[model samples]
Target chain A: MQYSNTIAILGANSEIGELIANKIAGNYPLLLVDQSEEKLYQLKQLVTEHHPKAQIELAVCSKDASWEADTIIIAANEAAEQASIASKIVEVTTCKTVIQIKKAHLDSATLHPMLPYSKFIAVDWANTTAIVEGKDENSLSITGEIVHMCGLKPLFKKSLI
Target chain B: MFEVFFSQVKDKVLLSEAEQKLVKTFFSPKKIRKRQYLLQEGNICRHLAFVEKGLLRSYNVDDKGIEHMIHFAWEGWWMADMLSFLSIEPSTYHIDAIEDSELLLISRPDFEEMLLKVPVMERYFRILFQNNIISKERRLISSISNSAEEKFIHLSATNPELIKRIPQQLVASYLGITPETLSRIKNKLNKNVPNT
Candidate 1:
């Protein structure tokens, strides 16, 4: 649903990641994490330029093993290895729910545009179907309902791991 | 296996003697030789089969004509394509006996009537569908993101009973990997295990 205070984006410099970040910049506290400091700064500039009132934070490289956020979105690269690492990052994060908006597991037709456009706005993400997997059924349902509130459809699936 | 199935069904659903007897009347015991087709493509899947003994597999032939195994239903398991069995359409999937087997089958209309007669069966099937969906989703995610080696580990960890019953190749197909890869992974696992 809505990340009340903090929202973290991994692989922030990537095109898709940046686009998603720009779209949600006005709604929540946006933190962009990328390995490239220059690119991170550029992303910040781009978001600020488009949505001047957007509250944005730039982390040059995410050295922290675990990040804390109410909600996290991983719009990283589509490489298998990258996906694996992103999964691990999600496992380690303190975030209650993690939304993975990657092309690897999903068809691009499901993408709801506007995350990269809205500024100083009520970014409603409800209507997105998130495939949720977790250790406990309660946790899985909780995460799914949160996404459901954001206008995102949540496909709750128990994880194999 | 029949004893277990009977106990499970009896314990889970409340059925009167008459309703239970009616349900049992449609069940025809069938013996299948190993590697024989239970239901083949282009044929109507007329029965909902319950595994009373041994193992069976339901598979689909891809465009390349390769058989991709969908599921292996062992003793005490139920296997069928819900869409095909519910509809009068010809089935695209094939189900075959993987081992010498025994099954109890019920026809479509009869089973539906039984469902109406035994209302508690709706709950039983609802839970069964939930469990089925959960397992399929797990397998789907493993196929999409996990590496071949990771998939083997994950599968072995999650479904040790399945690994014991189903052949390695079918397991590979379910994991979306080649048999050769499965063999290599198994070999690696064997070498890594401390003893035997």
Candidate 2:
């Protein structure tokens, strides 16, 4: 699927979320969504301070943010929280790219069943090279592009999920 | 349409006919009207544009909406927000056509692919980038240390065509001087010149 210019980060307050946001802030418009409004605003301030031209919007509702964004990034630390966010935005994310930043130990296939309509790509954001895995080559390549845009080398791994 | 580009490349490095054809395939030719914007300040600069004909200028808008000229691309010269293009960031400067222009544009991916496919072009880019840096350094020094009249004289000596082709107001902005000062300098210089 062709990705749009706007990207939504579900857990904008998380470390990984902020890191990814800061890296891609200049390239794409961002819709930052998180439960904590204060943390989301703080992230916006930090990103805008570094990238003065960065276009950032904050949202407390995951569904509304995901609905507006063509690409959704689930940066929630807990697998349950990621799954919960996916479930809330499932209807809005049909045929869209949903990238989940998962831990090395986490099962990559866990979110696929929840958002069957969306193209899912699991990213293991390692220190240097990020391992990107998806069911199809299209989504894998798209995810790899985004990973590269975030200043990480993407190593594509065939999904064993 | 690509004759100018091919000539510029040949001046730096010899290219085989086959390699030239390969390089040609990477760029798309575009025509822009005078005053048309090639890039806006808030947008990412996706392409590196080489001027085939006419002129283009890059400038920054201050908080008070005054424009500060940055650079100009004449025939055979290349233009882009280098920082935005390489880093995939939003551009701080806007690039616009000063005259109706024909340009050859290559996106970042194609630019990389072309370099890998035609490695000789790498030397060409190295020289181009080196010269660009040197020019920027000189401009920076000139802006900081040179007197207004000295700056005008230096610009006339280096780029006589710019003084003739561009408007007095824009030339003054590029030299970081007011248009009135530029007019005064021109009048003073013309008075000192011996009659033919």
Candidate 3:
């Protein structure tokens, strides 16, 4: 399941972003943003058909993450754009959790609650989706769920974040 | 050619001479000139390069054509676009030599072959990835939560070698701050905090 409030997915036109939206659109009220309005509408239609319960909205992409969202996913392939979007989100959002969905070095959630964004780079995208679906509070347990979801052994992997 | 890598592998798991030789056979050595690119944006990253000596930096250009530094790999470090390396897609990042460097390059096929040939290498890479993950997590925490001055101070305390080796501009870029901001932060640190 997704977060309680609105979850905005930036770069909805991109392939990876579209894939992530497909995985996550079922559970959350999604605000899909992309460069093309037509593409966003198509995605919204597809997602709504697949997930009738999902509340979805479409908007054209902008550099700023100005909308109110509890969680934000910058799934764009461009690393520079991701940083810019993330920083913009951090600047505008009030105590929101921002998750970067591209391949990055880190898995981060900023510590301060008062400060704007608590960011997490969910680099392991498939496992991240699996873990989120389980909604198991424990991270370790989520890793186990992810391993089970992938149908693979843990193979001595440690300390999933 | 393989001495530095063999030493690293030895630290994690023991490798016999034959195993070491097999591993070495998979990696080819290359010398990169300063400012010469090893990988470019829009091109598939063919090899994961390990720095036997000198420095390499991975970066990207933004919409306004502004360059942002993503990572730096000095001696004993690895530099590659993991997404591109694993998926064989066009890299969003470019890697270039900061200094005239010696590197050991392992192509995708050769890397897979090496893993099969030397089963113990799995442990070596796992440990390396683990270390990378830990540092990245720590870095992300600091970079996100802390102020520029605080970030600079923490970086100086922990990885002084990085600040010493890399230029202030690149350091500022890596920290997601402007050079002027970094300079101001350092100035403030020098004034308020002793031994900065």
DockQ of every model listed?
Answer: 0.01, 0.02, 0.01
lDDT of 1 by residue, A54-135 (tens): 8777764342312334345655565553455444553233213455554543433221121211010112222345556544
> For each candidate, what TM-score against the reference?
0.51, 0.56, 0.54
DockQ of 3: 0.01
Candidate 3 chain B: 10-residue stretch with minimal lDDT: B24-33
- Which candidate leads the pack in TM-score? 2
A119, model 3: CA deviation in Å?
A: 46
Q: Which regions of candidate 3 are displaced past 4 Å?
A: A1-161, B193-196
Pick the winner on lDDT between candidates 2 and 3: 2
TM-score of 3: 0.54
Q: Chain B TM-score, candidate 1?
A: 0.89
lDDT of candidate 1 at residue B139, scale 0 to 100: 83
Top-lDDT candidate index: 2
Model 2 Cα lDDT, one tens digit per residue, B1-82: 7789989989989999999867776665555658868889888998898998999999999999999998899899999999
Candidate 3, which CAPRI tier? Answer: incorrect
lDDT (Cα, 0-100) at A94 in candidate 3: 33
